[model samples]
Target: MQGEWTGELVGPDVWVSCRELIPAGSVFAFLAEHRAALSPAETFADMYPSRNGRPSMPPQVMAAAVIL
Candidate 1:
C-alpha cells in the first residue's frame, strides 16, 4: 500500500524548523521544499500490491532520503 506523509511539519515536539536551517538552493533545501510535488507516493502504488501488511513509509519521503 502507498503510505502518505501525514506527520506535522510544525508540531509541539518540533523545536527547530527545517526551513530555518536548510541552506537555500541546496539539495536538502530543495527536497524539503518540493518533496511531495516531485515524488507523490501515488506513483509507486503498484510496487505494493497487497493491502494486509504494515503501513510503509511514504515513497516520497524514502526518495527524498535517498537523494539526501
Candidate 2:
C-alpha cells in the first residue's frame, strides 16, 4: 500500500517555509517546489498492487530521493 499525503494542507507548511534553506535551481529546490506535479499517480500506482498493507513512502518523496 502506498501512503498518501493525507490531511497535510491543514497543518503547517514546513516544506514551503524552508525554500531558502535549499539551493535555488537545484534538484532539491526543484523537487521541493514541484514534486507533486512531477510524480504523477499513474506513474507509480502499478508498483503497489495491493492497498491493504502498511503504506509505502509517498511517490514524490521516493522520486526526490532517487534523483538526489
Candidate 3:
C-alpha cells in the first residue's frame, strides 16, 4: 500500500541517529537541513488522490530517499 509521509517530529533520540555513518562534510547533511525546512505535504497535495486508496509518499521524502 502507498503510504503518506507524515512530517511528524522525529524524537530527539533519533536525531543524529545516522550522524556517525554519514561523514561530517557530506552534502547529505545539507540536504537533511533543507528537507526539514520544506513542507512536503502541502507542496504535493494536488498530486495525491483523494479517496479509494492509500496516499503516496510525500514528494520531498521520495526525492531525498532517492538522491541522498
Best by TM-score: 1
lDDT score of residue 46 within candidate 2: 89
lDDT of 2 by residue, 1-68 (tens): 97775545565665778767888989777776786778866688888899698988778666865865
Q: 1-68, model 3: which lDDT tens digit per residue?
A: 33565557456523367767766667877767676465455666666656557656567767666766
TM-score of every prediction relative to native: 0.63, 0.58, 0.53
**lDDT (Cα) of model 1:** 0.71
Off by over 4 Å in 1: 9-21
- The TM-score of predicted model 3 comes to 0.53
**Higher-TM-score candidate of 1 and 2:** 1
Better of 1 and 3 by TM-score: 1
Give residue 18's lDDT in candidate 2 (0 to 100): 74
Once model 2 is optimally superposed onto the true structure by TM-score, how far is the C-alpha of residue 1 displaced, in angstroms? 1.4
lDDT of each: 0.71, 0.74, 0.62
Question: Per-candidate RMSD vs. true structure?
Answer: 3.4, 3.2, 4.1
Deviation in angstroms for 9 in model 2? 8.8
The full ranking of all candidates by lDDT, starting with the best, is 2, 1, 3
Question: Which of 1 and 2 is ahead in lDDT?
Answer: 2
Q: Count the backbone clashes (under 3 Å) in each candidate.
A: 0, 0, 0
Give the best candidate by lDDT: 2
